[model samples]
Target: MSTIEQPRPATSPSADWWRQAVVYQIYPRSFADLDGNGIGDLRGVTSRVPYLRELGVDAVWLSPFYPSALADGGYDVDDYRDVDPRIGTLADFDEMTAALHAAGIRVIVDIVPNHSSDRHAFFRAALAAPAGSPERDRYIFRDGLGENGELPPADWTAAFGGPAWEPVGDGQWYLHTFAREQPDFNWDHPDVREEFLTTLRFWSDRGVDGFRVDVAHLLLKDLPETLPSRAELAAMDRTSGTHPLEDRDEVQDVYATWREVFDSYDPPRIAVAEAWVATPERRARYAAPTSLGQAFNFDLLTADFDAGQFRRIVTENLAQSAAAGSSSTWVLSNHDVTRHATRYGLPPLAGREGKQGVEWMLAGAPADGVDRELGARRARAATLFLLGLPGSTYLYQGEELGLPEVGDLPGDRRQDPAYHRSLDQGTWTYDGLGRDGCRVPLPWRASGASLGFGEGAEPQPPHLPQPDWFAEYAVEVEDGDPDSSLTLYREALRLRRELQAAETLEWVETGSEDVLRFRRPNGWEVVTNFGGEPAELPAGRVVLASRRLDGTLPGATTVWLAP
Candidate 1:
């Protein structure tokens, strides 16, 4: 690798960089329109690094900028070494890395190890080769033709929809947990492992600080197919008939393989795994000290509305994570899911409680399909929940502005295959809608026209106009407003970093559903009231608030008190 001895920028200790450190997830297409193509490009992201630095994040996790067919929104890599032309060229990526490094902000790219697009050259070569060839072993291919070659050897459901197995040009079958366009790679193959490591070195040599590995748990599945019995399948409520629980014990070897590769790089890098399994145990396992540096715990994202629910989720994760690994990650929203605002809002109630029942009553509501006012409260409340936690926190792009889910459409309206296959043919109920709502264009500068995110020079008439509510809530607009959401976030970040507020903190339920108390050994307390009822809070010092509470906690008040 060639060397470019740019002045070494000072970075915080690797161990402590995560604390009080914010990470912004950039969904390339919606971030900015660089070529008038309506899609965000690498240069667009490079141009926005200054904006990210201003947001107080130490690093930015750019969602897959690699060569892809876009079958899975860039998750399906066709060539791991190259950058996609749709987003930008390799030169653009170099520029991005240099700029981010110069600004003291690290860059973390996504490496999808579990699968690859069907059009990938390796898979194509395997397809043309005869059965039992060395190349054919690189992927999982089955030749059993019991059910007209359409049925797979086992009864596994594809994550995108339908069966997980599909027939290629020949008489053989290939396994894909997502769209048929994506073929699952056999990690058991030595060549497969080498390819991933080389890919890591390719970008690491290009100055990528680290990686946010995609679907880390799915990289290795149960071997010898363990299908549940007919009666057991009927008794269960989940879509796990063909799950790989049988081979769960041996899956860590796959993670260990990646860890070995990351260890080879200088200055030691970080890896954040996306453990998408149902159980917290599996998620915790991926974050084991010997495994990846961090694995996101979605339990925080799936908590109930009350303080008790939040407490239980936090307590459970912290306990499990402490036992399994020293650290874990917390996330409220991401590209494939609904915005927090839409997920936590209560529906319109005709009862006497009115909108007051929104948070508590609708705690389980999916983030994508909620009403407006309830969405805002839920979004802001979620921010408080995320920042006050003990572990590292991840903020999806546009989360700070409290962006809500975009409305669903019928027919070609929906782009996410996951939503289309499972619920209402593409439309999701409050529970089933997975990620369609959060995938819309970001509301950046409120030109009042789709928040300035359209593809062409002229904005589309039907474009979801930028959330006007953000005019007062954006970074630029809120720099002066001491009471704005943007300001609250900035202050919370500053407190978390400067005062070490979230470190070594213990959450104590103050005997009130409306009030949440966070106590630290340093004689500090953080209280937040999600309810309409006011509660007496002990006096110390006010650290931050969504709205200034008049004497006590009123409805929907969040106060950070230090004693």
Candidate 2:
């Protein structure tokens, strides 16, 4: 159950409040910097409690802020129980939690159980111990294939790029599904499982309302004696659990156990899985009532700004989650992907597995690769459509300000390990940008060192440089604009709290394939026009809209109507 206060309705708010909530994701380092360190810390988050409350979100999901070398943007966490001194301390974290709770906002922290930073004590110990030592058993260390054990054990590739195995300069190799700095834990080891449960309770006791399980679909790999081709594994269905690395069947037992630890607390803590399974059905498995209880539906994230695709994703995800006795989740953008504002601007790429445009995304705005205005309009429409749905919604930081992807960020300043790894391997799979474009520090003010992100009297350059164009999307500028994306998000969140009392979604066929319409049990209607022509407004009062609405809803627009 969500511990935050909700608008009282006929339904009990204390029961499964996350089923219909607005959760804002705060990437700490980019959110706001305090102490002139050019790195956002816990104090900055605590100071922003008022802004969060004003945004009308029920909860905030903070990305990992633990001690790290920033190898993978803090996803490579060195410790689970404490904050990075560069960011803040454990006391700072406690204060942030208290402030958000005082403001009636629940807190959910990121947890990476799939892997551990090479700097983590366990990983360090494993590295120091002999190849056959117990410390090495804590992680997935194996013998190499070559006679000298120089070559990697298998042909498995890292999700980022290159070989997934890293040699310890000894006779053995260790598996790291991501960057070499993050070593995948051996879940078969009892100590590894116990340590995670203890870590969960540690933060829960400190008042974290929930957790966001990083790479939830990846755990408990099935290491076959005979390694399979990476291409063959890629072609296999993720739901089948036959792929040696992802969505393994044994991972279910782990969540079932985690559910027990979660329920032990009064007003039991909740968790949402960042699972990227092949289908809604596979994703739903991670959110089963006895599991995490919530998982992201990313189909919509990569979907083109089309009406039919949105409807199908909603229908499939909702039905699947409901069948699993869990609430659905809708997300447009996050730290890992291009922001929707830039994504919707790029034309759809057909031969790429229904993925949205990317060839243009890496082009960095040469000639006319991006249609920014069109993307923004579609993004606003798509967001409203997402908010009108009957489940929780995740809004990435800076998304409220309509921040476009910083695709042109200089190569020297790029910090994403995925980008460097791909480049080093000569793969350049993400066109050399990787995830850095969307992970840029947010712009708060029109001008200043780091765009007013720091509270220090002396300005400090942000860890990542903010572009000059960011001034147009600064929160300080948009906050006062009535038609700004910030305004749209604030109003939409506020009204959704007021009208989204029912979980049932009824389709309102608009007689056109390009137009999508749906109604709630409370007589509220959400309609979007993807067609070239304007869609006639249904018989209801215009409550709110992505753009100003008239007698009819214009193309690339979404509007909410009152009974």
Candidate 3:
């Protein structure tokens, strides 16, 4: 009964095409605007397939573009079966999918199963229906405490910065681990589980290559009585240890069911989890053969810009993924956090741990003493080092042009719920809590009404403003510059495909501890110098260097060598 035509058997490099693939993450609203609406849509995305293809990424992982009221920036889903009208329709998505496929790039859509927009039909019905009705059962609704039911049922805090419970007018409250407008689904309910399965198939039948499961670690939670205090939760180590609301063992069961659905197709679909669990071992569980195919390994993303830290994390990540019988995932930047260029420029904070690293980077005053040129140099070196590794790599949009976080975004134009929640709770200041800095629209051209993001004169202004300096890094400006970051990324990706056949990596001992040298099975070696001085390159012909070299790998630079 599916309207989609059966896909041709994949002519991909291998059945496990995800392995060794370089995937680009595209935030739809900011990518391009084909309709002159200022917001990037599926048509805009379709028009850019060739750009991505030429960029050398093997796949594109689009952020949520589903129907929503724009709460939490489309993470709040009102309907799972269709696209938001602001972005495009189902037909537009289909067209984009076909275009990407024709360009030999896989399409991985974002799926938010942990919660639904309060405006979703089921959530709306639950609000209007009386307490104890089945409509209410689809979500986690509970009775409030105290004499007038004024107090919340639990002490858990929202990830966005407020109480996790939101009261519905009828003396009952619903759980929302994030913004209040996004009501958490009761995964324990058969109806909720069945609905997600149907939604998964709805897209699968439409020929999406795979899905990226958002907040994959938070599908299950302990009973309300067992919820921990905010302080205790904050102090908990996500790298290890159990949490009432995160990385619960029961969540694997959910993915096991999803795995069955994924395998039903001829080529079998793939899925990667946005799971932020403690320990690489625990993170690997989500990528086990019977569960999701891959889980994002953020060890590299969270590691300090130190040689020892990067080496240790890379070793740990690879070992854990090997134990899980899955390939590891590497990523530098994503929409939710500061771009790596800016992060590298800022001094590392002491005692900062997982997820806190994001906050630490955001809260720090970059204006006081950030060396952006140094950050760009290091980021470029890191990109070559990341691509040289033996696994999948995810590139955030605009990183190719070395975009730095726009830390000075005006408060009024901010959109992240975290920013508003912080103000409402009298917690952190709004200056760093919001994520608008990293979500600014890409500047496609050096100059235009909207930097060539939208077509024609009188094009709509972007949802966010592009800084004047954006013109310096625009795609058109860097397109022909051989030394530009965009050129470096394209060349690195091209060379990566040629050098990626090697499945094993062996560490090469360098005299200095600050230098990391690794040799691939294919006689290709990657050396990164993180010390105060230049390091002698390994005895081989230089294939590519992050920056110009004078017969030595400069400090904060990386080079790929062919023996």
Q: Write the per-residue lDDT of candidate 3 for residues 295-382, one digit (tens) a residue.
A: 9987766666789988998888888888888898989899887788987876774554444544543444345456789889989989
lDDT of 3: 0.85
Give the per-residue lDDT of model 1 (tens digit) for 1-563: 11223333456447446544578888887776556455677887887766665566678888987787776778888999888897799999999888887777888899888888887888988988997787888888876456555555666667766777787746678888788888888877888988988888888889887888887767665455444443553465323324552225456776676677777766667788887766776567777767786777777565545666767777787787778755657788888665677655644232324234333323432323345666676567668757767767888887776666654433355556675565534523333444545766665554555554544676453212233453443445545567666666766766765455544667675777667787766766667776767778667788776676688775566666655
> What's the CA RMSD for each of the models?
5.9, 3.3, 4.6
| Candidate 2 ranges with C-alpha deviation above 4 Å | 1-13, 235-237, 351-367
Question: Model 2: clashing residue pairs?
Answer: none
Model 1: number of backbone collisions = 8
Instruction: Quote each prediction's TM-score.
Output: 0.86, 0.95, 0.94
Clash totals, every prediction:
8, 0, 3
- Deviation in angstroms for 26 in model 2? 0.6
Ranking by TM-score: 2, 3, 1
The alpha-carbon deviation from the true structure for residue 317 of candidate 1, after best TM-score superposition, in angstroms, is 1.7
Better of 1 and 2 by lDDT: 2
In model 3, where do residues sit more than 4 Å from their true spots? 1-13, 224-243, 351-366, 429-431
Q: Model 3: C-alpha RMSD to truth?
A: 4.6
